[model samples]
Target: MANIPYREVLGSLMWLQVATRPDLSFAVNMLSRFANNPGRAHWEAMKHTLAYVKSTTHYGITYCHDSNIKPLGYVDADYAGDTDRRRSTEGHIFFVAGGPVSWASKRQDTVALSTVESEYMAFSRAVQQGIWITSFMDEIGLPQDTPVLIYADNNGAIANTQNYKNHRRTKHIDIRYHFVKERTANGDIVFEYIPSSDNLADILTKPLARDAVIRCCVGIGLRDVEAGGVL
Candidate 1:
């Protein structure tokens, strides 16, 4: 592990994710946690990511003039995804002009006792990104409609945002996560329920099968220049 260039490879992957590879966000974010002490398994995972990158060099986000300019967001979370700490992984992506403008995949700072709680935390993160996206759009003279549409797969979390009632199942969740509820109430953002199978943000919260990955890639407007079509 000491001899391997783990940090160097991670650095390169990080740049790729930040610049042109929203599809690699989850993999790179997960592997980066082991930069200080990567083992054989981590190295193997890094190699797999590198191989995927190599295979999809022609893949890039495609934006069309007819695409929707209004920013939309998708958010999801994997409950107890972290093997070492049992923390949830929250992921989000914002789209403009049919292409991803920003996205993120990160483990939650606190352990969530329920899937709903984790989803709520993910909602909070997505709302923060939505606020920023709307602000930028306004500055560029593309002001968005009120109550920015944000999609979530969890009905429980969506209900939480709509209802102010405190229940035992969610009362224990941190006050910070309730920021999403405030945003929803104020019409700054809205959480609409989407089916898990159709949620694009699912790709960012966990490792996916090949078909699911390809579907998500296409959903995010990733296209292959060589193939001249969505990937």
Candidate 2:
């Protein structure tokens, strides 16, 4: 089947995402959804994605022990981004030692009715992942300080988690998704607003210009190591 090549292509992209290109994780994940019966257009898009990767093959996340910055996270969601189902995509990045250690891009299971709901869902997933990372770090004796910061561009979503008075609009959200509020109340994490320009997670959720992509990659500490540096 012609579609078989599409699956292999997507699988290759996924391997890149998991290995060195966390920046491509979300886009690859989104495109992989259409691999079952890819048309010519989809194949073209896949080629373009591959070309982009080839152009920036040197980029990668680097974790250096020299930096003292505390571990932090950034999260954002693209509201109703999927043209077919109007579903949102969630993107997040976790940084330690001034570099990204973990990140993800995934489509929301449920279609969000509003931008706030989409952002809330994204934040919820980020919180869950944050908890898991915190636990794992603790197990490794690298526990982070309290109030791990999570940045979001959506003010309404932050308000929803920080305050309980907006239930009129959010009452429809599932109880499981409301766990972000609990984490906020317990002081395990704090949600703050970050201007879109500074949201590193944007690279995961959308196609950006080459300059923006390079800037984000640098912010995540992906760089070319010199001969003097550790190999």
Candidate 3:
């Protein structure tokens, strides 16, 4: 681990993640967490990621022009998934023209008290991104006529956010995360539930099985250029 160029290789993957591979964001972000003091296991995980990229080199996002320009979003969180810090991992993806345009995966800065809290935090983060993207779209003369739709897998979190009165249970959460509540009140972003199985952000929230990863990858618009057409 000490001898391997972990930082350099991770940087390369990060560039790919930002440019075209939204599916790689989670693995890249997770690997980047250990860039400073990578263990042997971490190095091995990096090698696995590289192997994945090599196998899916033909896969990439395909954007079609027939669809509207407004962004569709999904967000999810893995409850207390970080082994070292007990922090949840937040993940989100935004799509426009029927293909993923922006995505992120990262360890949360604060530890959540419950699964609902983690989902709420992740929802708030996704709202912030959605708001920013809305503004950007307006600037480009493609203003959204309706509220941005954000899908989440947690029904409780959706209900909690739509509740104007902060229950005693949720009073402990930081006031900053209430941004989602305010935005929702103004109809800037609408939250709806998608089954966990259909939530594309699930792939970004945790290390999934290979089949699951490929499924999410395709869901996000990655397709192979090979003749087989099966990834």
Per TM-score, the best of the predicted structures is 1
Which is the better candidate, 1 or 2, if ranked by lDDT? Answer: 1
* Model 2: lDDT to the true structure: 0.82
How well does each candidate superpose onto the true structure, as a TM-score?
0.97, 0.92, 0.95
Q: Write the per-residue lDDT of candidate 1 for residues 67-142, one digit (tens) a residue.
A: 8898889999999999999999999999988899999999999899999999998888889889999999899898
Per-residue accuracy of model 2 over 26-141 as CA lDDT, tens digit each: 77977888877788888888889999888766565677779854668899888888989999988999888888778999988988889889889888888888887787888898
RMSD of 1: 1.1
TM-score of 1: 0.97
Candidate RMSDs in order = 1.1, 2.4, 1.6
Against the true structure, whose lDDT is highest? 1
lDDT of 3 by residue, 104-169 (tens): 998888899899999998988899899999999999898986699999999999998778876765
- Counting clashing residue pairs in each candidate, in order, gives 0, 0, 0
